[model samples]
Target: MNAIIDKLKMLKYVEVTASWLFANAKGRDAKTFVKSPQFASYPEPTIQITSPDCGASPATLSPEYMAGGDGRLPGLEWESVPGVKQWLLICEDVDAPLPNPICHGLYLGISKDKLSVTNSDFKPENEKSTRLNGGFYYGTNRLWIPPRPLLNHGIHRYFFDIIALSEPLDEKLAASKPTREQLAKEIDGKILGWGRWIGQCERVWK
Candidate 1:
């Protein structure tokens, strides 16, 4: 009976994998057959900032940041890319064990003069006080505190995205801590480049 159940599970996995491959293959083939010259043009790559190091994939529990040591927030750094008037920081957990990714944090209109910020730097009284969602201003320090009964979900990948805009945004908008939708409306076409860092985390304890 156990063997039969295992075989059924394996079959289901195979079916899902095959279906995904088939869909992806068809999409690639369709793209290749497109004759439009406009479709041939590829967009330029965006500049990226990372923690530990760019392109370095580490578990969120790594010692890179104090909070991340226990599946919390990670430390971050970035290279100075040319033509970056301003930057936006967005973090999402792709492996949320759900249909859609979960947002961890977001900061927009980061000044070019600012270099690196640690988990502690995100505290309410820190320099970015106004950037927090509410007037309370929960910076990296505060945001890292896992909710009660710590979520025991599967591995979650935190995507730290940085977008370099072509033009500087209005100072008023930056100070107000606008929603992502608000920023999208003002800076959609003005995005000159962007970058991202991905880190994984999981709650091992139930």
Candidate 2:
């Protein structure tokens, strides 16, 4: 039994060494062959949002709720970006049924002063109710409709984009459901930095 244990330990060490060697080789190859793009040419700085000190899980929609109708999760907050005057919130599912990704939610002109928002927090009655789907702010929509691709389509990655702008966005401009293109045009060369949080939703039903 002692001999068997010793052999297992040796095997573990060998496996770790092999993995380390492979990773080193891959790094070397990438450095040798890959011509990485400069940071200046990138669209925007990507900041990843994670749970605070207690190690909280990323915001997630309940499977039961998702299957039923409601698909919004609560408990979302982030630290203010260093030099943001205005912000844009975009939630997209990268693993859609093909063609293109699914846009779950797109919220722009978020007030920088407000940090956190809870579930059903967008209600008209709520003090922080901003704007949605153009003019009518229907509070929190209980039924978040995901683009359908039949059944068992696969896992979908939801990217919640928070963009910090150099100038404050005009309220009139944000009154309508502005396209990403339009937003980009308005904030062209004015984007200071950006951040994102990712959560995943997968089809569990057959």
> Which ten contiguous residues of candidate 2 have the minimum total lDDT?
26-35
Candidate 2 lDDT by residue in tens digits, 113-139: 756554554434443444532222221
Which structure among the candidates has the greatest TM-score? 2
Per-residue C-alpha lDDT of model 1 across residues 96-117, encoded as one tens digit per residue: 3333444467666676655555
Pairing residues by index, what is the TM-score of model 1?
Answer: 0.60
| Candidate 2: clashing pairs of residues | none
Specify the highest-lDDT model's number: 1
TM-score of each: 0.60, 0.61
Residue pairs with colliding backbones in model 1 are: 122-139, 122-140
Model 1 / residue 34 / CA error / Å: 24
Whole-model alpha-carbon lDDT for candidate 2: 0.50
